[model samples]
Target chain A: MTAGPVLKGAADRVLAAPAAPRRKGHPGAYLRWLLLFAGGLIMVAPLVWMLSASFKFSYELYDLNLIPVEPTLRNYEKVLGDPRFLRWFGNSFLIATIVTMSNLFFDSLVGYTLCKFRFPGRTLIFIAILSTLMIPTEMLVIPWYVMSQKFGWLDSYWGIMFPGMMTAFGTFLMKQFFESVPDDFLEAARIDGLNEFQIWWSVAMPLVRPALAALAIFVFLGNWTAFLWPLIVTNSVEMYTIPVGLKTFAVEQNVDWEMVMTGAAIATLPTLVIFLIFQRFIIRGVVMAGLKG
Target chain B: MADLALHGLTKTFGKTKVLHGIDLAVQDGEFVVFVGPSGCGKSTTLRIIAGLEDATAGTVEIGGRVVNNLEPKDRDIAMVFQNYALYPHMTVRKNIGFGLRTSRLSRAEKAARIAEVAGVLGMTDLLDRRPSQLSGGQRQRVAIGRAMVRDPKVFLFDEPLSNLDAQLRTQMRLEIKKLHKQVGTTIIFVTHDQVEAMTLADRIVIMKDGVIQQVGTPSEVFNAPANVFVARFIGAPAMNLLPGSWREGGVALDMGGQIALPGRQLADGTRVDLGIRPTDLAISADGAGQITGAITLVEPLGAESMLYIDAGGVEIIAACPGRTAPDPGQQIRLSADPEALHLFDATTGEALR
Candidate 1:
């Protein structure tokens, strides 16, 4: 007997010839792309406007025009010629560099400890450090101020830089990455006659590059753009980081909008360059840490 | 080359005791394979011997010196990890040379040793490549090369071939045996695959439930299994056991059968299990035999066929010629030579001659 109609129909579909346009059935596909494009443009428009304002005359700041009618180098020249601006730039560079180096060293040490070592209360210690990530920086400012006052560190670089030289999020990120390195390698390293510290430096550290890059970028950016703590702790212009110094454009009577925009624009260059250089590592680190860790 | 010995080795994690007390000895240059199921403490025993894990009680001796308190490097042994454990950032040359970092050898000597190891592994052309660039077998060879480069007194392999595919595993298994012969270092290898243990080991140490059941050469274990566990565990498809009790003339099987005992004897009315391999239980050419059953199923393995027959109350496995594959529901009479049967004390699961 011949096969039923439904079976024959299924067989025909299963054995159909190749090279045919398969299917497309979703609705509003082009509209989704359009809406996404609009959302991205909205997010990027402020930066574009800040760049445009950096090159504009003070009178052109209020308008919605992206390209200034009179784009001039006068504001840039003013920003570059001021020794106060150069000092603020140097302050930001030094503080960010110091904080990044310290965070990379201390956070990785703490992370390797929590990940590999079998010390008692390891999980408790890790939880304690990670719980610090939940504490809002705004809430910790009073205690920090009291401590700084007791240490006579107000208006100094120490008060502004000490609170953020190491972080909990960095330790957590590094621990997540270090867990993927095999325990066998560490045992092998021990048999090879390297001490624990040397093993951490030579064998374990090289395997977690993505986390290092992510942590370095994070620590550098966090310190460079710290406005509230730096503003509260430092009164003099000599110790003001870039973010705190950018606020100095607000004088008592009126604000110099062109100079502020110029400073803010210049302050953003290093972060943008860092992001561009390590874009692959940052994206892959976030993806790997989120999905696997 | 050195002798390795474990004396009264016992391990306990908190209140859970893993290894009760294990004592074993290995001759110099002997390839000893620890074969067991997972959680049988074979890996733990090996780790204790390597000094990676401190024994809770007992002493490990290498070259007749107590090494229980010594560090792994101080104990003069090297291990090939199951995952190969090569540093992903380093080339094969650097990875192999990493073990010599603390050695007092000159740079030229370290280079020569690394090159010699790479030559032995036949991976000299691939020395510059990272582990990520090599195949699974090549990574295994690099691990072995790193172990061999040290020329240590002993080598510990922790299931090093468990990661490869079937065909690659076979190929690597042969190469590892040849490497063992060439170097002649005392190697303690651990694997769960009995075929690997049988083919590669000079002596196989079989373990179960954190205890060694038997230790013998392949022929000894195959010919005379110490107990039921070893009897069933050493061979494929396992040995078939038919429970029976003693009779006046011979051992009367549980269901309505009796097989003559040629030379072995047991007390009357004693309960026992008759252990017979599938190959020894022949399907009789004539229809009549001691045990008559109908073929319930057949497995065609090309070279031989396995028959599952119900010989009264119990179902059993028997083998037949491949080309004469039996059909299901066909009547069959199965029997084994009296000399080929293994009788075990049914209660203790111990062999009875």
Candidate 2:
């Protein structure tokens, strides 16, 4: 009460007023909402079809309706009942988890080094690493295969993960984020009696959490849904990841499309959850990366 | 805790030399201030002493041992940066105790040390807050506390108060001086603000163009500057320097006045500059003064006023009593005691006697 007048100043009142109402009354707003809703339907149609198909029987596959009239749990039953399906799911989980962990650790370490340390040829080395991003993955797939064969890593977890253990894109992302950490903080840490590694780990790393979270989500989702490298290197049924294992549903003569859709629907869950949880970071990280570049 | 000395300290970034052979000896528990204009290498000299930067050629000795090749941590020093550099993600308590991460102190001892420092800095309640939540002054206190917790041989402050507003800067300046008094640790503070240098230093090292111009106590530098640059830099409103040539009984001013040098004799045509503080120059109502000038501007400061006068072709600033200052366009005679004048060699700019 003592400071009531001051607290209720005209400027404060103006600022405390509610944000402008949504422009729903305008024709432009109506057009924008209509267009956005149409685009949303187009993007989500395939996902809706997949979900719809997962509930239908093989005979009902040709139906164009989004909701099946004869929906049954039999497709899920057949997909879950198979032992090989579970093995493939587990394999994908293991490979994706390991690959994501390795990328996060090695990429951030190399990024911190390339960004913070001063040494001869540092710029050249960073350039060399970044130059790899220019090379097409298809061009290097044969070499990756040859290297895996030479190391006897074919049909193994290491073969699927070796190429992605560290990536140029991840390194570039981490370095761009590390650039925001002040050199003064590092100097203060050094004067505080911290070694270079300690400074990087404690002071430098914590400051770029948003970048790290964004990187983690990107790597995790990329590996989780990865098809090309995993499909190429892995040979045996036991080693096939979800994407490769899902292919087994389509035989030479008869393609079990319903079962395939069921597996895909289940595989989509983890990535969807992850994306939902960290959607804001992804948007922020992308905008920041574009601005910084 | 340590007397520090720099011998032939020099730094070069590629072809540009930043610090050129800086030499000074700081006594144990002495508070020394490095004051200079920007690009004058005051911060660079501080960085080299803290070992954050490598001197191109010099040896830094702390407590009589060369620490040229030692890491900053190994050099037994702590630095407070201009940006504070407090870890944004860490709480104030953690930020202050960070230096102790490498110390062998027990957990309880480290906490106690942090608590004591926080108490001294009056940041006990704010210890749980992050730097983002703190005001500018509080963040500065956290930075000082972080440096204090180390209790190293010397404390290095690189223009630590430059980021604060004018009011906060003065308050923090007093706190830092009182802190030095209580802790009695050797401190090397770098600032371009002359007031900070004058009010806080036991000895002020004034530098220009990467070279130390004068190193002396506040009073010594204010009263008897080593050179023309020091004379102008150490005081507010700057000292008035007039170009002239030596004559028989005195120096004849180039702007139409002659100031007598009673007992000294010099070459008749030697070029010299006569320096006088604004405080020493007074307006003469009787028209019997060394130089006469028309007042162009009057800036009052409550108790005193600064008069910008045009004496012939030269501009001079004189301090006058605020209430007694005459209006602009009034012609006035300015006078100063011959004993209070400073004479510098015009060519070299070095003080003579």
Candidate 3:
């Protein structure tokens, strides 16, 4: 008997020959490209605006104009010529550098301890340290301020740098990263006659460079852009960081819009440069930490 | 090379006991394999030997010296992990030379030793590549190479081949055997796979529930198991057990059948288990056999066929050669060779003869 109509119909669909399109489809493809272009523009508009404002003259800022009417180097000149601006920039650079390096070294120290060593109260210590991450900085602000005053640290660089140096989040991030590493690696190194310090320094540290870099970027960015803490502690203009100094420039009477934007632009540059350099490591570390946690 | 011994070894984690008074000895240049199911303390025993774990109450001796307080590095033993823990950041050459470099060895000597190990492991071409760049087998080879560079007195392998595919595992198993022959270092291997234990071990130690059930040569363990746990564990298509009792002149099966016994003189009314290997079961066409069975399932494996038969109220497996694909639901008579049969006391699970 011949095959049924249903089976024959399925066979015909399965074995159908290729056919040319009845209508042109280029418009749909172009429309998709247009939507993508619009999305890109929307995401990049703020950055373009910031760059444009950084170059505009003081009179051109209030015109609500996208393009600068008079793009001059006068704002940059004013910002660079101010001695306070240079001092603030130097202070910010030094603090961020110190905090970043200390965090990288010290957090890994504690991270490796928590990860490998089986000391008494290890879990308790880890939980205590990790709990610090949940406490908001704002909640601790008053107590920290009073403590800094008691230490006679207000208006000093230590008041700002010391508190920002060691962070619970950095230690937590590093501990999680170190835990993902196989225990055998450490045991193998130990069997190689390497001491505990040597294992942490040579083997564990090298393997965790990516995580360290990500943490460095995070700490540096946080320290560089820190406003509230620095603002509270630094009363003198000499010890002011860029963020605090920028606020001073904006609040002064007859504020130069161009100069303020230049100061803001300068403050944003270091973070941008750091992020651009270590963006891949930053993304990888974030994804790894997310997966591990 | 050196011999090692464990004396009254025992371990406990909090309230739970893991290893219960285990004692063993390994001669120099001999390979001992610990085979058991998971949570049987085989890996724990190996770790204790490696000084990676502290035994609760035991003394471990390596090279005739007690190493209970010694660190792993001081124990003079090298271990190859199941995960092949090669340092992912370092190249193969550096990974092999790390231990030497950390010691008092000079730079030149370290390089020479690395080169020698690379040559031995056939890893000269992969020396410049990192661990992440190598395949699983290559990484395992690098791990072995790292252990070789140490030239320790004893080597411990914790299921090193469990991570590889079946084909690669067999090839690596043979390589490890050859390596043992060449190096002549005492080796302690841990694996749950009976095939691996059977193939590579000079002596196999079988364990159950953290206790050493038996230790003997491969043939001894296979031919004469110490207990029912071992008899059931050592062989494939496990030994068949028939419930029976000693009668006046023979053993009577629960199904009202009887097999004539020699003058062994088992106590009357003693409960016993008759054990027989599948290969010992002969197919007979005559109805005069001791047991009759119906073939319920047949698995033809080209070289040999396995028949699952229902006989004497128990299902039994019979291995037959020569492509004999018996049809399902067919009647068959099975009788064990009188000389090949095994007798065991039912209560103690110990061999009767």
By TM-score, who's the top model here?
A: 2
Please give, for residues A185-226, the per-residue lDDT of candidate 1 as tens digits. Answer: 889888777889989999988877767887898889889888
DockQ scores of all models, one per candidate: 0.32, 0.41, 0.27
Worst 10 residues of 3 chain A by lDDT: A1-10
Sorted on lDDT, highest at the top, how do the candidates line up?
2, 1, 3
- Which is the winner by lDDT between candidate 1 and candidate 3? 1
Compute the lDDT of residue B268 as modeled in candidate 2: 93
The parts of candidate 1 lying over 4 Å away from their true place are A1-42, A252-254
Best candidate (score: lDDT): 2
Residue by residue across B23-89, what tens digits does model 3's lDDT show? 9999999999999999999999999998889999989999999999999999999999988878876
lDDT score, candidate 1, position A106: 91
Q: In model 2, what are the clashing residue pairs, if there are any?
A: none
Q: Which stretches of candidate 2 lie over 4 Å from their true place?
A: A1-42
Q: State the lDDT at A248 in candidate 3.
A: 84
Candidate 2 per-residue C-alpha lDDT over A25-118 given as tens digits, one digit per residue, 9 for 90 to 100: 7998899889999999999998999999999988889989888999999989888999999998899889888888888788889998998899
Write the number of the candidate with greater lDDT, choosing between 1 and 2. Answer: 2
